[model samples]
Target: MTTASGGWTVIQHRYDGSVGFYRNLSEYTDGFGNVGTEFWLGLSYIKEIADKGNTTIRMEVSAADGSSAYEEWPEFRLGDAPTYTLHVGGRGIGTAGDSVRYFEQGNNGSDFTATGSYCGDIQHGAWWHNSYCTYINLNGEYATPGTRSRYDNGWGGMVYFSFKDKSSLKMSTIMIRRND
Candidate 1:
């Protein structure tokens, strides 16, 4: 069977000298009836291995359709390397057929306009953008930017940053609507 959009696999390491594995293969419907999938894989060293207390574990992953971006928030510390790489080459699709279009205003405080921002494709993935909105350009368009958007695909994933005249600005975002 084909994996769902958000299927996941998980592996666990218990106190015993054995390992456990689990996979979440089916999609789920939220309160709004929208369907989504999720999968994860984790490993645990046997009690003998963890007792050492200084061993480090390494991990590698390959995924698409925003699967690779899902992760738990790591604690804030020095020298953290949370990285993501996407291998996509083509003009992504939009809600209105193959055209790209979207509008954004109040970006960076200055009034600017951009085109080619309507990208909501599922196969080619969608645009994902996170910016330091200084001037707040209320009108901007992103064309094949490869950065996910909240307007499409319910939650095309994204990371954002903001500042308020030197002081830290707390960013606020809403989740995608759950429905067909």
Candidate 2:
């Protein structure tokens, strides 16, 4: 792995799409021969509804950045719907209007950062309800149906929700590409 001067480390290896960890990149294992530290495509989990029109997928991760923390979740796959508990914690935690945005991946492995909208506080579980879902906009803003929602409490940053109840709807169909 080569670290860029800006701090983004680029890891080079084959990603078999199995299960493993990477530095500053998505977790993946290219094959069995290359173990940890080598470039390998570990696993790629994806969910899609066969007979549905709107494809909305919700993924549960370690709440940490980079691929290493992502590998912490066992049996990870794409499209497999799972309920999650949302919390906020980070350097960008508290401040008026600051928040963490959630986004779905595109076909190319890019974050599509511009498309992400703010869902809740980036620091931890600050803005959320037991059974509430919010929509996002291109500017990373959280909103209800039509109007704009405000994160007034600078102390709370914002609110976010997760799969608190197991009985909720099936999140999405996951397609596990590879498992190392």
Instruction: Evaluate all candidate structures by whole-model CA lDDT and list the values in order.
Output: 0.19, 0.21
**Residue 179: error of model 2 in Å?**
3.1
Clashes of each: 39, 51
lDDT tens per residue, model 1, 1-180 = 122232222211111112111111111000111112121121121112323332222111112222221111111011111111111112322221212111122211121111222221221121222232222111112112233333333232222112111111112111111111
Question: Which candidate's TM-score is highest?
Answer: 2
lDDT of 2 at 27: 23
What is residue 83's positional error in candidate 1, in angstroms? 2.6
Instruction: Output the TM-score of candidate 1.
Output: 0.17
Model 2, residue 92: distance off in Å is 22
Lowest summed lDDT across 10 adjacent residues in model 1 is found at: 21-30
State which candidate has the highest lDDT: 2
